[model samples]
Target chain A: NAGVTQTPKFRVLKTGQSMTLLCAQDMNHEYMYWYRQDPGMGLRLIHYSVGEGTTAKGEVPDGYNVSRLKKQNFLLGLESAAPSQTSVYFCASSYLTPSGGRQVEQFFGPGTRLTVL
Target chain B: GIQVEQSPPDLILQEGANSTLRCNFSDSVNNLQWFHQNPWGQLINLFYIPSGTKQNGRLSATTVATERYSLLYISSSQTTDSGVYFCAVGDYNQGGKLIFGQGTELSVKP
Candidate 1:
């Protein structure tokens, strides 16, 4: 089964251009997250959704927006992309169970590499 | 906000050697996980140890929740094990959002 998949594995955008990255998960998880990975910065959260129709701001949400219109799909939008926004983006999902002790392990998609010129 | 820090920033090991990586976080956490980002850039989940200890094959991890630190032990390292390891914490107050550490880049030479 395809656990998590991201669309547009690679993209090149000119400054001020708009684009969207799509993430789809078949795990039927309730939590989905969007993160950007920069050299030496690890992975910083961009935005996240607890479930369909719910979204929240993350550590780095200034230049990005997100929508969880469907339960299995999470979308990240860059309205006016800049060179500084260029980074590898990742989408992850996890199943939150009622049990307390076990940590919810997140399943990540391959990643989307964006280059802004 | 809770902050996460990973030690050694970078490490180099010869094949079949052993190494350890450390992660420290400020404040309490509900959950924590370890991920290995391969050279191809795929983030693979390695462990989900919020506390206590766990082992799998040549890898093992220990989390001292009370001390706010975690350690990952890699035994018999191979060239294929070269990658960046990241520690992420999940806070209940943050709706289970994960805060990631800077990561420790590992290079295993043949």
Candidate 2:
């Protein structure tokens, strides 16, 4: 299994440009998340999905959107890129119970280095 | 909202040395994890310790849920152990949302 794979390992975008980051997990996980890591800062959640058709905003959900149409794929979209959005983006997935009781370990993908100019 | 804090933002040690990294959370957590992010930015899961202690090779972790803190120990450090160590906590009541600490950067020199 690839665990988690992210496309476009690296990218540079001009200001106001838009793009979507694709995250795929072969672990058959039920939970997926998008997070951004800035220099000297902790990873902040951008968005997450509990299941195939459910999505929710996280700590730093502003300036970003997400969609989880399939159980294995989670996509993060930037409507208009900004310099502040430039950071290493990581995609993670886990298996959790439907009632939100037990927590599972998260498997993270090799991050994508994004530069917004 | 939950707060996660890691101590010794930067640590420098020589080969074969041992060190401890700490994480303190603001509230009770259902899941506490330790992750190592290599220089290439790939995060590797080290442990999922919410309570008690667990050891793997030269690395071990302990989480005291009542005190809302966790510790990760690295023994006989190697260059491969050099990277940023992050402590993340998941709130079960909040639908398994993970909050991370700023991470402790460790530099092991041979």
Candidate 3:
């Protein structure tokens, strides 16, 4: 099963250009997240969705937007990209077991590398 | 807000040696995980130890929830074990969002 798959494995964009990265999960998870990783830094959350049609801002959500139009798809949009926005992006999906404890073991995508010049 | 921190920003080990990586977090958390990002850049989940101890093969993890720290023990290290290890945490208030530590870059030499 393709747990999680991200579109456009690699891309290069000039400053101010816009693009969208697509993430799809076949695990039927109820939650999806978007994170960016810079050199020597941890992955920081940009946005996430608890379920279809619901989205929330994350630790680093200033320059990005997200939409979850379908349960299986989450999209990250860079309206006006900047050099600082160039980073490796990851998408993950998981579920909080109904039983208890709220344990989460996320499944991650391969990642999308974007270079802005 | 919660914050996660990992120690020994980098580590180098000879084949067959053993090592331990630590992760400390501020504030309480409902979920905690250890992930290994291979040289190929794929993030692989290693452990989901929010609390207690779990062992698998040459790897074992222990989480002392009360102390807000976790430890990942790698025994008999091999060259193939070289990678960046990350610790991520999640709280109930964040709607399933996770905070990740800077990571510990490990290099195993033969």
DockQ of each: 0.68, 0.79, 0.77
For candidate 3, write residues B17-96 as lDDT tens digits: 99999999998887899999999999999998889999989999999999999999999999999999999988755677
Instruction: Give TM-scores of the second chain, every candidate.
Output: 0.97, 0.98, 0.97
What ranking emerges by lDDT with the best candidate at the front?
3, 1, 2
TM agreement with the true structure for every prediction: 0.96, 0.97, 0.97
Q: How would you encode candidate 3's per-residue C-alpha lDDT over A13-117 as one tens digit per residue? A: 999999999999998888899999999888999999988999999889998999999999999999999999999999999886887436378889999999999
Looking at candidate 3, what is the lDDT of residue A24? 99
Residue B77 of model 2: what lDDT? 98
Looking at model 2 chain B, report the run of 10 residues with the lowest lDDT sum. B90-99
Query: Which stretches in model 1 have alpha-carbon errors above 4 Å?
Result: A98-103
Question: What shift in Å separates residue B89 of candidate 1 from its native position after superposition?
Answer: 0.9
Candidate 2 fnat reads: 0.72
Model 2: which residue pairs collide?
Answer: none
TM-score of chain A of each: 0.94, 0.95, 0.95
The DockQ value obtained for model 2 is: 0.79
lDDT of 2 at A88: 96
